[model samples]
Target: MNIAEFKKNLLQDKISSAQEWFFIISVSLLCMIVFISSDVFLPFLPEMTKYFNTSMSLSQMSLTAFIVGLSLGQIPHGLLSDRFGRKSILNLMIPMFLLATLGCIFSKNIEFFIICRFFQAISASACIVIGRSLFSDVFEPLKAQRAFAVLVPLVSLSPALAPSIGGALSIYFSWRSSFVFVFIFGLIISLFVFIFLPETKPIEKRTKNLSLLSILNNFYIMLTDLKLLYYIFIVCFSTAVWWVYAAGAPLMFHKMDYSAAIIGLLYLPAVIPYFTTSLIARSLLKTKSVNYILNIGINGMMISCLLLFLLESFNALNVWTLMISVTLVTGSNGFLLSTAMSAGILHFSKNSGLVSGLLGTLQLLAGAFSAALIGLFANVFDKHYYVNLTILFIVCGSILSYVLKRKVIKHEAIKSF
Candidate 1:
C-alpha cells in the first residue's frame, strides 16, 4: 500500500499491483549514458579514422579494448554491488565515466585514446549488469520480466538515438566533442541516481572477499546448469548478430554515399523495433513461456539472416534491405536479452549478485569476441567486406540458437530426471 509495503512485496517476490516503472527508467537512463559513448563511437569511425590517421584495424582496437575492460569488470562490480551496494557503484561510475570522456576529448595520441576507452568501459558497464542483478533481486520473476520489457525499449532508445546524435554532433563539431556530450550525460545521470536512487542490496548478503577461487566456483556452478547456459547462449548469439551490423553497417553506409550524419540517421531506424518490442515483450511476460518467446525471437533472427544472405546472393545491395534485416535482429534482441537475463539469475537466487556478475562477464566477453571477429571482415570504405561480415554474424547467431536449443532440451531433461 505504501513505499515500505511495496519494497517488502518486491523483495519477497510477489507481483502485486505496484508500478515501479520509474526504477527501470532510472537504470535505463544510467545505461543510456554508457551505451551512447561506446555504440555511437562506431558510426563516426570513418571520420575518426581520417582524423586520427589510424588504420581500420587499429581504430577498431579502441572499441575492442573498451569491451575487454567491460568484460573484466563484471565480476568485481557485481561483488562490490553485493557489499558496497548498487547506489555506491552507480555514484562511483559517474565521476569515473566523466573523467574518461574528458580524457577522450583531450587525448592527442591513439595510444592515449585507446587507454581512455578501456578505462571508460571499466566504469560504465557496472551500471547495466549490476543494475540488472538488482532488478532480479527486487522483483517477482514475472514482474522482473515485464519490467525489463519496458526497459528494453527505453534502453534500445540509446543505441537508436546515440549514433544520430553523434553523427549530427560530429558533423558540426569535431569527433572529440561527442565525448563531451557523453561527459555531460554521465554527469547528469550521476547526480540524479546519487540524489534519488535507493540502495537495493542489503548489508547481510554482501560478500567482502571476491577471490578468484570463489569466482571460479560460482562460474563452475553456472556452467554446469543447463537452463542458465541455454539462456546465456541466446544472449551471446543475438548480440553477435547485432555486432555484425555494428561492424558492417557504417561501411555499407559509406558505400551508399551517406555522410556520418546520414549513416547515423539510417542506423537509428533499426533500433525502433527494439524499443517497441521490448515494451511488448514485457507485456507478454505474464502470458507467454520463456521458451515460446525465445523460439519466436530466435526464429526471427534466423529468418532475417537468411534473407540477408538471399539479398547477397541476388546482388541486391542497398541500405533499405540492410536496414530491414538489422531491425529484425535488434527487435528480436528485445525479447532474447530480457529472457536470457531473467533466466540467468532465476536459477541462482542465492547468489544473485554473483550470478549477475558471471552472466554479465560472459555476455560482454562473448559480444566483444564476436565483434572483434566480425570486425575482421569489415573495413572502412570497403562495401564488399559486408557480405562476409553479414554471413559470419548470421552464422554466429544461428549456432548460438542451435546450441541454446539443445541446452533447453537438457534443462527439461534434468527436470524430468
Candidate 2:
C-alpha cells in the first residue's frame, strides 16, 4: 500500500492480533533503549574519571546531564507529538540520538562527552514519552494496565543488563565501546520504526491548537491537579530509590576494590525479585484494586528501608546486606510504578501524550536529583551515610504517598457523592 493508505490502516480502531503484539514489542524495545542509555555507561564511570583526569563527581555529571536532558526534553516531545504525530517525532529523534552517540564515542574531553550525553538523552526521551502515549492510543484502561505491567519488566531488564554489558565491553575493549553498542542499537531501532511502527495518533486525534499559550495552559492545569501529582510523585519516589541505589552502589563497590565485571554481576540478583514482583503485581490486578496493590508496595518499601537502617545501625551492613535490602526496594517498585502510571494516564486519557511526557520528565528528574545528591555527599560521607540517606528518602516518600492516597480517596468519594 501507499504511504497514506498504510498510515490510514494503522489508525484503525482495532488492529490484528499480530499487529498488536508487534506494536507492543516495538514500544517495549524503545523504552529499553532509553534505559540502556541511562545505565550502560555506569560501569565505566570510574574508568572515565581516570581517563579524563577528573573527579568522580565530574564523571557522574555525565549521568546527571543525561537525566536532566531526559527530563526537560520530554515536554517538547510530548507537545510536538500531540500536535504532529508519534511516528514522525520518533523518526526525528532516533537520528538525533544516533548523532549524539557518535559524539559520545568520539569526545576528546569529559566536558564534551557530558554535552553529548545530554543530547543523547534528549533524543532518547522521545522513546519513553511516545512509547507510553501509544499504549493509551491503542488500549482501553484495563488492557493498558496489563500492558504496562508487561512493559515494566521488559524495560527494567535494561538497567539490570546494561551495566553487565558495559563491564564486559570495558574489559575487552574501551569505555567507548559501550557508546558504539548504543549507536548500533539506535540505528537498528530507527530502521525498525521506519519500516514497521505505525502512526497511532491520527490527524483527527491530534491537538489542533499548537500555540505556546495553549501548551502552557495545559501544563498549568495538569500541574494543579492533585490526583495526577500524587500518581506522578508515587512513580517519582520509586524512581529516586532506584537511582540512589544505582548511583551509590557502584561507588561503594569500586571503593571495596571490586572489579567492574563483578560489580556488574552484583546487579543481576535484584532482577529476579523485580521480575517476580512485577508478575505478581500483574496477577494481583485481577482480584485487587489499584489502591490495594499500591498499599502493599508502599508498605514493602517502608519495611525494606527500616531493615536497611537496622542493618546499618548494627554494623552488619556489607555488600550482601546492602544488595538484599536494595533488592526488596526494587521489588516493591515493580509493584508500584506500573500501577500508578497506568492509573494516572487513564484518569487523564484525553491528554495521554502530555501525561506520559510529564510523568517521564518528573520520574527522571527525581532520578537525576538522587544521582546528584549521591555525588554531592559521596566524598563527605561514609557508606553508611548513603544507606541512611536513602532510607530517609524512601521513608519520606512512603509517608507522602500514604497522605496523597488518602487525599485521592477523599476527593473521589466526594465526586461519587
| Residue pairs whose backbone atoms clash in candidate 2 | none
The digit string of per-residue lDDT tens for model 2 on 87-139 reads 98998889999999999999989999999999999999998888888788877
**Model 2, residue 416: C-alpha shift (Å):** 1.7
TM-score attained by model 1? 0.82
- Show pairs that collide, candidate 1: none
lDDT of 2: 0.83
lDDT of 1 by residue, 24-45 (tens): 7766787666568876776677
The 10-residue segment of model 2 with minimum total lDDT is 1-10
Candidate 2 lDDT at 367 equals 81
The lDDT per prediction is: 0.73, 0.83
- Number of the predicted model whose TM-score against the real structure is largest: 2
Per-model TM against the reference: 0.82, 0.87
